[model samples]
Target: MPRKVLVAYGTKNGSTAQIAQIVAEVLSKAGLTAEALPARSVTSVSSYDAVVVGSGLYAGRWHKDARRFVRRHRRSLAPRPIWLFSSGPLDASASERDIPPVPGVRRVMDNLEVTEHVTFGGCLEEGAEGRIARMIVRSGKGGDFRDFTAIEAWAAHIAEELAGPESR
Candidate 1:
């Protein structure tokens, strides 16, 4: 049987949520069963074969709900194939390697033993953009800077990895 991958995320506005949906769509196109759902909509992960968690970064940390979800489900998630991502570092020419990890990500990295962790350039928009975006825009750093190709490639890689022998 094919594995069921859950792509869940927390977003202040909707950028991060949109990213998660894109990831799920890419993964599904690769022949996997993938669902992109908001963090709050996910109750029990018992049926998932793997998990992809994402959140927007603010104040040098992930959104509070993202952290809380991970903390609440750590034990249940530890044994699975888990991946993490943070949306941060507003519109810029910064390289992927240059995108800094959110503050609490260090502990999450250590604790979850996450299979993968990535950072994407954040977008700055008003009329509902979160605190982080407001700050970045106010500081003259807000813009849409995400690389869709890189994002799709990474999702494909995850799908390939999940199709391997061990994931079964």
Candidate 2:
């Protein structure tokens, strides 16, 4: 049977959703059945072999829905291979080390034995901002800073890992 994977994300302004779609595509290419869904829509993951969850970081914290999903499904997710990612940091120069997941998020990582948590550069498009975001933009803190190549490479690596000895 084909391995099934779930790519769930919580996005603000849609960039993280695009990232999740790319991840699901990469997993599909690796011969795994994968689907990308918003965290809010996913009620259960018992049917999947693995799960990848991501969220847009806000002020160094994950989106509330993503956090809640992890909390709610912790038991169901514990037995599966799980990967976590955070999409944040509007600066192009931001590195993974510079954007570690928040403390609350880190707790889940430890509980799940997640080896690593990736932090990707974020995109903030014009006219997609709220009042505070607009104010930050006026201070020169906005643009499309996502590194697609990095995201793709990471997804491909996940696919390879999930593929196991047969694919290698």
Q: Per-residue CA lDDT of candidate 1, range 69-137, in tens?
A: 888888888988888888867755434475646669878878988888888887667655556457767
Candidate 2 deviant stretches above 4 angstroms = 95-98, 165-168
lDDT of 2 by residue, 41-83 (tens): 9999999988999998888788888998998899998888888
lDDT of residue 51 for candidate 1:
93
TM-scores for all candidates: the values are 0.89, 0.91
- What is each predicted model's overall lDDT from 0 to 1? 0.81, 0.84
Error of 1 at 49 (Å): 0.3
Give the top-scoring candidate (TM-score). Answer: 2
Q: 138 in model 1: Cα distance from truth in Å? A: 4.7
